[model samples]
Target: MSKKLAVVTGATGGIGAEIAKQLAQNGWRCLLVGRNETALETLRKSLGEGHEIIVEDLQDERAMAAIAVRADALGGTALLVNNAGLNQMLPFENTPSSMILNQLCVNLVAPMRLTQALLAQLKRTHGTVVNIGSAFGAIGYPYQSIYCASKFGLRGFTEALSRELDGEVQVKYLAPRATDTKINDMKVRAMNEALGNKMDSPELVANEFMTLLNSSARRRAIGFPEKFFARLNGVFPELVDSAIIKQLKTIKSFLGTKESSL
Candidate 1:
């Protein structure tokens, strides 16, 4: 049998790197995609022979073509993990238009384009598309409107695309809540302290994702209270809204002083 090929974006980051490592260890020939050449090379070496690396900015128009060329060279791609994302916590009014555009390009548009480019190979293998989303995608949060919007769009796109595929391909949305990644150290630490809990490790989330990949599960919401909150928000919007408003006050207090304008 031919070896399964899996492509993972943001493979230099904590979660993405773990996912790539797990996939490679689990008998799949992994393709690591990220902008960090040094990190990508390091990961590739760690993953051993047969693993490949492609360094390209996901926001670049040529990124899809680069991915396609790599896929062709790999013989075919069986799984595509769209895990690259960007987030910033700031008042909406203060957020620059350029930042918003960058967020959209990285978080939403890149995945869409990459998926479209790899559809044929995936269809041939009856492969899967794993979209790494967030809890904020399911519910809105203060100071993260643009980030939430991007995730929500990704979630919606995954749901609709899955239905459209009708089993020709598998689609899964993995939502991990407030992970202890280096991306937002201070903020995450503050939130954890305030909530009296620790942030989930990227490795733990990666393990859950690997399990889901081997199962028939179409969607997974990771984390304890966050998952519960997401479901609650879905069932009772008003209650969820009230709770978030109260939580926002606490978060604001933690942040110290609220800005009148963006």
Candidate 2:
């Protein structure tokens, strides 16, 4: 029997790495994509044989095309996990235009472009496209305006794409709440010191994501409180905004001073 091919972007990160590992364990020949050659090599070695690693920055359009070509050579792609993203906490006005562009490119554009590039192959296999979004996508957060915008765009894209590709492909948006990845260490510690809450663990988030992957659910939002708040915000916009504003006042106290411009 031929092995299934799965592609995961940002495969060096905590959640992405775990997803690649889990998928490989599930009998898929995983194609790990990331900018870090060292980390990718490390993960490739750990995953042992069938798995392949592609060291390419998703931000480069040509590189994404090359990824599609590589997957095609592997007997067509069966799954594409668009998990590459960037995030930073900064006041909206203070965020540089370049940073905003970079975030949009990595978080939104790359996924959309790569999906477009690989659509034919995925369709042939009746494959799935998993977009790793964030809870911030559902609701706006203070000091995360741009990040939220990118995620919101991603969610919107996923919803529309899921409907458009209803018959040909499975499209899913998995939104994970604040996870205890390296990205959140400092912020988590500060939040814990002030707001009395720490981020969730990456392993926990990864497990939730795997559950979503196994289920037929079109949208999966991790973290109960965030999910509830997202739903409430969707229904009661004004009330939710007011409540979030009040909550942000407290959360901001824990955010600490801006260390560097995002």
Candidate 3:
């Protein structure tokens, strides 16, 4: 019996990298996938022998197919972490079509496609699929419209699939709130600070992800007020809308958009 394999996307840096390292530490052989070969290789070496690197962009269908092929060859892939994501904080009016498409592709489409590709193997191994989501997935923020849509779609996909494949395979959604990662630009960081939103380190997210794997829970949303707000928004969105409305001016200031135009 060999070690169970875990295919982790976005293993190059930040939360993804931390998750990969933590998985390796927990005795799982990881298939580190990312566009940066150098970073992936460095991470793979640090993780030691059995782990491998797949240098491919998730946005490219050919690259994704290649990843499925490699995973098939590797055999026992008991876990798939769709952790790769793209985020940008901008007013919807200022957002270009390309940015919207790119965010959707990386955040939602790639995860769906990659998961579909590996469904057969996962079923054979009775594996788990963990989709990394965000607090905004549940409570839509003003400037993060497209990001919220992508994560919301992911949460729905995970929920439906958890029921869809209950006995055969496990499906889980892990939502982390305002994680401190390079994914958040300086402006976004400043906005978070101004809003007094607490940011969790990448290691904290990795640990929470590990806990999710060991537990039987189907979904776990990190943070205190964020998790509370996520549930609140689901039951009473109007209340959340009113609260966000109060902070709308502060949020808008971070958008870097002109006041007159908005």
**Each model's C-alpha lDDT?**
0.88, 0.86, 0.92
Instruction: Name the better of 2 and 3 by lDDT.
Output: 3
* Prediction 1 global C-alpha lDDT: 0.88
Across 44-112, the per-residue lDDT of candidate 1 in tens digits comes to 999988999999999898989889888878888899999999987877877999999999999999999
Error of 3 at 99 (Å): 0.8
Candidate 3 local lDDT, 71-145, one digit each (tens): 989985789999999998988888999999999999999999999989999999999999999998899888899
What shift in Å separates residue 118 of candidate 2 from its native position after superposition? Answer: 0.7
Model 2 ranges off by over 4 Å: 254-262
TM-score winner: 3
> Candidate 3 local accuracy as lDDT?
0.92
Per lDDT, the best of the predicted structures is: 3
Off by over 4 Å in 3: 260-262
TM-score of 3: 0.97
Instruction: Write the number of the candidate with greater lDDT, choosing between 1 and 2.
Output: 1
166 Cα displacement, candidate 3 (Å): 0.8
Give each model a TM-score.
0.95, 0.93, 0.97
Question: Which parts of model 1 have CA positions greater than 4 angstroms off?
Answer: 254-256, 259-262
The stretch of ten residues in a row with the least summed lDDT in candidate 3 is 253-262
Candidate order by lDDT, decreasing, is 3, 1, 2
Name the lDDT value of residue 251 in candidate 2: 64
